[model samples]
Target: MSKQHEKLRMMLTAALFAAIIGIMAQVTIPLPLVPITGQTLAVGLAATILGSRYGALSAIIYMLLGAVGIPVFSGMSAGMGVIFGPTGGYIVSFIFSAFITGLYIEKTSATVTQAFIANAIGMLINLTFGTVWLKVMADLSWAEAFVGGFTPFIIGGILKAFLAAWIGILARKRLQSARLLPSSTKLSA
Candidate 1:
């Protein structure tokens, strides 16, 4: 593909990923601090598929859209206030999680095991950011923050990570078979 075409493809991919994240945010299970949303899966998939820069860009786009009052966030809420709310940390975490996960997948190449590792690490980063943000935002103790936010989502997060990793592996296989992705050596470099 020509340079222009490649750029267009990347932009399209980023938009698609952003849309997926936005849609996933709408699918939520209510909880105390932050609700459970399918966004983690979307983030993992974006990272696995698009690599670091594009994955991060996609997340940035999602945040920007939500911040601009698109109601793309969980509970269909938006604005800078949301970013500073209890769930704000989780939102911020998406950027790092996608970037790190994508970097891991891109460097190691996507395999079931590698995807699992990447997703796990990425989720950890998310939790870290989220928990800290929640504590500060809500003025809660560590235990309270854990109970209100992190603890409730552990099992779900694991399951989602596994699911995302599995899907990522399958997608990678399909892309490779279809010659959509570059070879491993080229991707690694």
Candidate 2:
């Protein structure tokens, strides 16, 4: 493909992943503090497939959409209020999670094992950021934050990480075979 076409394809793919994150954010299981959502899964998948640059681009686009009142956040909430709200840390963490996850896989290989490790780290980052933000924003003690925002999501996070790893690697391999995805080196370039 021409360079222009490749760039356009990557851009469109990032946009599509951004939409996927928005849609996944609606899969919420409510809790006292943070709700469980599929946003992290989508984040993992994007990074595993697109690597650091496009993956982080997808997250940035997703956040920008929500920040501008696009109703793309959890519970369909939008605007800067959601970005600066109690749950905003989780939202903000997606960028780092995606970037780091993709960077890990890029530096290594897009194998299931590497992806799982990367996703697990991403999950930890997400949880840590969210818990601390919840504590500060909600004026809760660390214990309360751990209980309300951290502990409840551990099991679910693990499952999501594994799922993202398995599914992401599988899909990435298929896309590469079909020439729909560029190689990691090409992506970095």
Instruction: Identify the runs in model 1 with alpha carbons over 4 angstroms from their true place.
Output: 179-189
Per-prediction TM-score to the true structure, in the order listed: 0.93, 0.96
Q: Please give the range of 10 consecutive residues that has the lowest summed lDDT in model 2.
A: 180-189
Tens digit of per-residue lDDT, candidate 2, span 79-123:
998888889999999999999998988888778999999999999
**How far off is residue 103 in model 2, in Å?**
0.4
The best candidate by TM-score is 2
Which parts of model 2 are misplaced by more than 4 Å?
Answer: none
Worst 10 residues of 1 by lDDT: 180-189
TM-score of 2: 0.96
The sequence of per-residue lDDT tens digits that candidate 1 reaches over residues 97-116 is 99998888878857888888
